[model samples]
Target: MEINIPKGGITITKLLLRICSILIIIALVTSVDGSKGNSASPEESITILFTHDLHDNFLPFEVRRNQGKYTVGGYARLYSAIKEQREKDPDAVLVDAGDFAMGTLFQTIYASDSPGLRMMGQMGYDATTLGNHEFDFRARGLAASLRAAKDSGDAIPKIVATNTIFPTDDEGKIPANLQALKEAMDHYEVKDYLIVERKGIRIGILGLMGEEAASNAPMSGVTFDDAIESAKSTAATLKNDEDVDLVIALSHSGTSDEKSKSEDELIAQKVPDIDVIISGHSHTMLKEPILVGNTIIGSSGEYGEHLGVLNISLDVNKKWKVNEYKLIVIDDTLPLDPTTSETIEKYKQLIQEKYLRHFDMEFDEVLAYSPFDFTPFSEIGIELKEEPLGNLIGDSFIHTVRELEGNDYEPIAAAVMPYGNIRDSFGKGDITVSNVFNVNSLGIGPDEISGYPLLNIYLTGKELKTVAEVDASITPIMDEVQLYVAGLSYTLNTNRFIFNKVTDVRLQDFDGTKEEIDDHKLYRVVAGLYSAQMLPYVNEKSFGILSIVPKTKEGTPVTNFEDQIIYMNGNQEVKEWYAIANYLKSFDKIDGVPQIPVYYEQMKNRKVVEHNSNLFAVLKSPNRIIVTAYAILLAFVGIVVLIITLIVKRRRRKK
Candidate 1:
C-alpha cells in the first residue's frame, strides 16, 4: 500500500502516526519522572503511623545515657503522637509491627487484663502483628490475653498473621490450648490479611513472623511458614483476588544494613507487589525510609522510643512514591493523652492489687539508691566486656541463692547472666521494685507467673572455661550469647584463634580475691531459668566445637528446667527479679534508703580483654582447637601449591 501527502501537509496516516509518537513520548516521560507529564489520575496519599517492639511500656521510663538520666517513651505519649498525625491526615492508618507485651511490670497482667491490646485499641491502632515476646507466657497465656481483650469489649486492633501456623494433631484437630487460641483468634477476627478503604484508597495489609522471630519463640507452640513465601502468596491474593490498590506488610521480620540478613528487605526484593512494609523484631530504627524498587520499608525504634510516620502518594503512573518519612521521638516534650494516661494508671492499680501484693511489695517501693549509674542498656552488648549492671545482677543471683539456701547452702561458684536477659539498667537515683523487675522481666515460670525463676546447675571447671571461650568467640557472631559472671573472671586475647580466645579463667570472690579453677571439679552454677535452658543449645549454636552440659549436683543431665527452680519459701519460685530486689533491699541503708555501694561503680575485671597483636600474644598457648585449625589451613595451602605446580608442568609439556 502507498500513501501520498501533499507537499508540506500531513496525510491522515501521518497525522495519526505523529499523535501516537507524541502519546508514547508523554507516557515514557510520565513513567520515567513523575513530575514531567500531566496524567488524569491525580495523586492520592495515605499516611501510615507505626510502632513496634513496644514491650509493654505503658508509662514513661528512665534511660541513663551520656552520664544523664532521660525520661522517654510511654503509651500516653505515643497515643498523643498518633493523634497529632491523624489530625493532619484523618485517613492515616495506625499500625504496630509487634512485641507489644512482656517488658515492664505491665506485662504482669498480660494474660489477665490484656492491657497491651486494650491500650493499643485506645491508641487507635488499626492493625498489628505478633512478635516473639507476645508468646513469652506461652500459648495458653496468649489465648487468655486474646480472650480477655475480646471479653473486655474493648476495640483492640485487628490482628493479621499470615505465616503463624497452629499445629494440629494426627486427627487434624488442634490441641486444647491451641484450639482455645484459634477460637479466640476467630472471635477476634484474626486473618491472613485485612482490607481497608481510606479516602478512596483500598489498602491490603498482612502480617508475618520472621525467621529469627520464630526461632526466638520456641515456646510459642505455633510454627511459621517461610516469610518470603507467605508474603508472595498473600500479596498475590491481595492484588489479584481482593483487587486492592496498595499492599502493606506488617512484618515482625526486621531489616539490617546487611542485605543478606535483612528479612524485610529480602521480602521486598522477592515480592515486588508489596508496596510498604512495617518492619520490627530487631527493633531497628531507620532514620529514613528504605526504598526497594517501589516498596517502602520503615521501622520505629523499640520501647516506643519513636513513632514512625510514612507518607505515600500516588504518582502519575499510579504507583506509590514516598512523600515524607520521619520518626517522632516520644519524649517528655509530648503531652500525654489524658484518657490513655488514666487507663494506664488504672492498669497500674490492677497490677499492684493483683500481682504486686503477692510479693508483699508496693509498685514503687524503693529498693536502693544508687550514687552512680550502671551500664546503660543500649551499650550492654555493643562490646564484649565486663558490665557493672551485669555484675550487679549476677551478684544478686548469688546473694539470693545463698540467703535462700541458708544452712543448706553449697558454695555457689558462679551465677551467670547473659546480656540478652538483662532488659534494662538502673540510673543514678532511687531504684524501685519496678526498676528491679524491669531489668530481668523476661520469661514465665512453671506457675505461669511473669518472671523467670532462678535455677541451679553444676558445670565442670572445663566447661566453665568453655563458657568463657563461648563468650569470647560466639559473642562476636551473636552478641546475645555474651555471658556475665558474678564469681568468675577470665582473660581473653583477641588475636588468638576463634574459639580459643579466652587465655585464662579463674573463680573470683566478690571481695576481689582470685582462686584457681580445678579443671575436672564440679562447680555449682546459678542462672535464670531461661538462661539455664538455653545453655544446652550453645553446642548447636557453636557447631559442636563447644559443649556445655548443665547437670544436677548428683551429675544427672537436666531435661526439665522447672524441676531445678530454686525455691525461697516452700514452693514459691525464686524469681530473677525478686533476687535482684532482695539483694537491693539487703544493701546498707543511708537516711532510710538502701544505698548501692561504690563497689559496683567500676568494672570488677571479670572479663579482661588483651587486644595485643604481638606475635607472642597471638601465638601464645595454642589449644587443641587452634592446633586443628592450623593443621587444616596448612593442608589446604599445600594442596593449592601442588595443584599450581602441576598446572605449570602440564603447560610446559604442552608447549
Candidate 2:
C-alpha cells in the first residue's frame, strides 16, 4: 500500500496506527466503566426539588402587570408539590437557595419570632443558604433564626454560608454565640458542599450569595466575601476533594436580560465546574435553563409564585447530566399533598393568631382623605410632580423634630429625597391610618443622621442647579436626591438647561410672609440621616449641622433606623407651615387657586419659615388629646381652689 511513499511515509503510518489504537482503547475503557456503573441500577428513581427567594408571599394567586396569571409560589403549594414528589420518589431532597425571609408583612412578623425557618425545617428542607434578607435583622436576628432552626429538632436544613464572617473581639476571639452558631452550623449545617447519593448517582450542591446584597442589606455586624473568588475556591475543593458525580450551585446572585448584567451568568462563565445554577435575587423566571458550556442556570420569580424543577439523568458511569428542567406554576389544578397543606395551614394560623394581632390595631386605621388616587407615575404630573405624599412626609419629620426639641428651634434647610424611597401613594379616598404606615414603612430610628430627624438642607437656586447637573453627569456616584420640601416651593425650567432646573426662588414664612431669596443666604434643614449622608448636595455644602432630633414625635429614641413613619394627614394640614408659599401663590392664583403650572414649580417659589415642625396632625393628634386632657384636669383644680378660698375666708371672718 505504501509502494511509492516518501522517505518518512512508513514512520507516519506507524504513528497514525498508534494514535488510533490509543483512541480505541480509551473508548473501550469508557464504555466498560459506564456499563459497570449502570449494571446495579434500580428500577426506582430519585428527584430533587429546589426553590429560592420565597419572600414570605404565602398568599394565593394575584396577577400583576406585564407578568401573566402567576398563580403559583406559596408554602402550601410548594409543600404539597414537594410531598407529591417525595411520594413518587422517596429519596427526594428538597432545598431552598435562600431569601426565605423579609419581603411581605408576613415575613416581617415571622422574622420577629423565627417562624419561617422553623416551619421550613419542619417541612423537611435538606439545606439552605443565607440570602441578603436573611441578614436583615443583622447578627442578632440571624442568630435567632439559626437557634430556632436548631431547636426544631426536625431534620433542619443545614444552614450554609461560606462567605459570611463575624468580626473578632479584642482578644481575637469570635463572640461565644457566633462561635457556637458557627459550630452548630458546621455540625448541623453544611459549610461547603453537600453530597446527596440517590440510587447510584452522587450529586454535590454548593451555595453562593451576591456580594452587593451585603452592602445594600441593613445588616451591620456581618460581612460577605467575594462571591466569584469564594465560588472558585469552593468549586476546586468540591471537584478535586469531594469527588461527586455532578456539581450544582444554589446561587443568590441574579439573572439578566440584554441590558442587565447577571452575576449568575458571570459565575457560570468564569467558573466552569458548576453543572447547574439555581439562582434568585433578581427574581427572574427563566422559561428554560440557559446552557453555558457544560453548565445550566435557572431561576424562579420572587415570592412563592413559581416552582423550579430540574430533572437529571445519569449515564452508566454515574455521571450526572441534565435531561430536562422547567419552572412549574403552582396552582389549584396541580395536586396538593394533604399532609403538607395541613402543616402550612397550621403554621399560617399559628402565625396569624400569635404574632400579627397588633397589625390590625396599629397598621389598619384610617387617618385622612386623599382627593386623587396616587401611583408612582403620578409624580410626573405638574400638580403631582412634587408629591403631596412626600410633602406630607417632610412635614411630619419637621413636626416630630419640633416636638422632640421644643417649639423654639426652627428647621433651616432640608436634604434631597430619593424617588425610590417613596413606596406607596395616598390615593384620593379616606386615607386610612394604615396609609401613613404604608407610605412611611421604613422602620428607621430616631437618630439625626441614620434616624428620621435627618437635617437636610436645600441649595440656593444657583446651587440647586449645580447639584442637579452634577447628579446627572455622575449618575453612578451621585446620591439619589429627589427631596420635596414642605414650606419651600419651586419650579424647574426644563427649557433652560442649568445645574438644576429651579427658577424664581423665594422665602416663605410660617406666619404667611413672602420675600425674594438672596442667593448668598444660607438656610437650615432637616431630613432622614441616610439621605443627608448620601445626597451630594447636602454633604458637599457648608450648611451648619442643626441639632439632631429623634425620628418619632412620641419622644422615642431612634432605635430602628431603617423604619420610616409616614403620616396620611392632608396637604391642608401642612399649609400652615407653607404660609409663605401659600402667600406667594396667592399673588398668582387665577380663581383662589394657585397659578403654579405644576406642583414642583410651586415648591421653587417657596421658602422654609419652619424647617422641621411636628405640626403633622396625624402625629400630633395623640399629643393634642393628652394636652387637652391635662388642661381640663388643671381647670377643675383651679375652680376647686377658688371655692375653697371663699369658704376659708368666710369661716375665718366669722371666728
Candidate 3:
C-alpha cells in the first residue's frame, strides 16, 4: 500500500483535518447555544399575579358565549385560582387594576358595606387602583365606601391613587364632599405609590387614572393629574429614590385599538422605568403581554373573568428576563373556595336586606323567563345596529313610565338609551332581580339609591333627528354613545356627510305606525337620568356642530336633572332596572312566571342603516352643517391655489 500511495495523499489528508476541525467548532458552538454553557443560573425568579376591572362579580355570573351560557368569574373561583397560583409561587405579588366596584347587586352597598374592597381584601389583593366606576356613586359615595372599608377592619388592599386631586375653592379650601374624600383617603392610608418586597425583590406599584376615566367620573368631584405626568413622576421616584427592583403601574388608564387612545401603552412608552403595567378601565382583554421597550403591559379583562400571571427571572446580566406570561381563565372548571362562597352568600343576604327588600324583591327573585338569549353584554355596543336588549330596555322604560303616570301620562315620542348605560344583557332562562339590576346597574339616583332613576325630558323634533344623526355618525367613533331607541325609527345613510348621516327621521309607534315628525314640535322623551344629563354633552362632543339641549315640557332650558326625575306610586322613584322588571311582569305569564315575548326576539326596525356610495344620494339633502363644511373646503382650496399661482409668478420674474 505504501508503494502504490495515491498522488496528492498528503494534500487530501490536510483537507480532511481542516474539515474535522470545522465540524468540531460547529459542534462546540451548537452546544454553547443549546445549554446554559458558561452562563450562571438565574439569580432569582419573580412571579406577578394581577387582575383588572373586577367589576363586583363576587359570584359566578353566567355569560352568553358561542350561543351557550357559560359560567365565569366569582370570588370563590377567583380565590381558588389565586391559591393555585400561590401554591406554584407563594411569594407572587398579587395586585389589581381597578373598576373593582359598581357592577352587581354587591355595589348596591358599596358606600355602606364596601363589599368589593372587603372581598378584594379577603382574596388577598396586595394593591389596587381606583377606576372611574369607583366614583360612580360620586365622590361622597366613594368617600363613604372608603370609610366603610376602613371601619370593617378587614385586610383591605393598599389603594394607590397617584393622580387623584381635590380641587379647592376660592377660599383655598376643598369642598365638603371632596374634603371628606381626602379625610377618608388619609384614614385608609391610601398613597400615591406603595413598595413591597417579594422574595427579596423590592416592587414599587403606582396607580394612575386616564383622562377619559376622569371625564367619565364628572360627578366624582375629585379630579386627576395628567396620567402620563403622574406615571412619569411616580416611576422616577420608585426607580431613582426608592431603588426598587421592579416598578409596576396599576393603571386604570386602559388600552385601546387606537394608538392615540391607548393610555397604558403610552405610559409604558413614556415611562421607561416602569417594568410592568396592569391596565384597566376599557375592559380590554390582552391575551398576550405587550412588550414596549423593557416594559410589559398586561390586562386580565373585566368582571374577574381571568387572572394574569407574569413570570420573570433575573439573569446574570442583572436584568429581568421574561420567563412566561398567561391569563388563567376563571371558569367553572376551577374549584370554588368554600370560605369565599360563604362570604359571598353573606354579602348576598346583606344586599337583600339593605337594597333588594326596598323594591319588595329577593336577590334571586325571578323577574321573567327568557326562552332565548339577548345580545351578550360584551356585544351590546360593538355594532351600530339596533340591539334587541336595547329595544327591551327602551320599551320597558315607556311601559313603566306609562303605568306609573297612569291617566297623567303624556305620550312619549321616544325612549332613548345609551349603549354605555346598558351594562349587562339578559341571558336565556330565568331572569332574576340581580340580573335586571346588573343590566341597568350604572348610577345612583337623587334618592341616594343604587339604580339610576328614569327621567322625562323634552326635545324638538329637529333635535330628535339630530339624535339619530349622532347615533349614525358619532357612534362609529364612540360606541358607548350609540343610541338605542323605542317609539322612534330612522334610516341612516353611511355615505352622508358628518352630522348629516340620517337620511330619514320619523316617529314609529309600537303598533307599527310611522308618522312625520314636525321639526318645531316638542316631543316627550324618556331616558335614564344619566342619559338625559349626557344630552347636552353631545354639543361639546360634536364641537358645537350638532346640538341637543334637553328642555322642560314648558320649553325652558333644564338646569338640574334631579328635578326632572320621574316618580311613581306616591314618591317611589322610578328606577330604570325596576322598569325592566315591571315590563317583564306585565308580559303574558305561563305557569305564573312572566315570559319574555318573541316580539323582542327580533329587531323592530328601530334603526335602518343604508349603505350607499352614490354621490347624488350623499348630497341629496345637504343640511346647514354640510353646506358650511363645503364652503370652508372651497375657501381652503381657493387660498391654496392662489398661493401656488403667486409663488410661480414670482419664480418666473426672477428667471
Task: Show where candidate 3 strays beyond 4 Å.
Answer: 1-41, 169-172, 627-655
Q: What TM-score, over all chains together, does every model reach?
A: 0.89, 0.62, 0.89
Candidates ranked, most accurate by lDDT first: 1, 3, 2
Better of 1 and 2 by lDDT: 1
The Cα RMSD in angstroms, rounded to one decimal, for candidate 1 relative to the true structure is 8.4
Model 3: number of backbone collisions: 0
Candidate 1 residue-wise lDDT, 1-655, digit = tens: 6467769677778789899999999987655332222122346678999999999988889877666777899988988899989999999999999999999999999999999999999889999999999988888899899999989998899999999998889999888878877887888788999988786667899999999899999888888999999999999988887777889999999998788999999999999989999999989999998889989999988999899999888887777888899999999999988999899889989999988887889888988999987778887789988998889989999998888778988999999999999898888889988888898999889888889999989999988888899899999899888899888899998778789888888999999899999989999999998889888988999899889999988888988878888886687888999989999999998999999999999889999988988988888788888899889999999999999999999999999
Ranked by TM-score, top first: 1, 3, 2
Higher-TM-score candidate of 2 and 3: 3
lDDT of 3 by residue, 1-655 (tens): 2333376456556777899999999987654221221122265678899998888988888877666678898889999999999999999989999899988899999999999989989989899999999999988899899999999989899999999988999999998878888999999999999988775567889999998888888888988999888888888888777777788899998899999989888998998888889999888888888888888898888899899999988667655668989998899899989999999999999998888877788988888999988878777788779888989989999999898778988999999999988888887799999889888898998788799899989999899999999899999888889999998889988878888888888999997799999989999999999899889989999999999999999999899989999987667788999999889889888999999989989988889988898999889888889889899999999999999999999999999
lDDT of 1: 0.89
Specify the highest-lDDT model's number.
1
Model 2 Cα shift for residue 286 (angstroms): 1.7
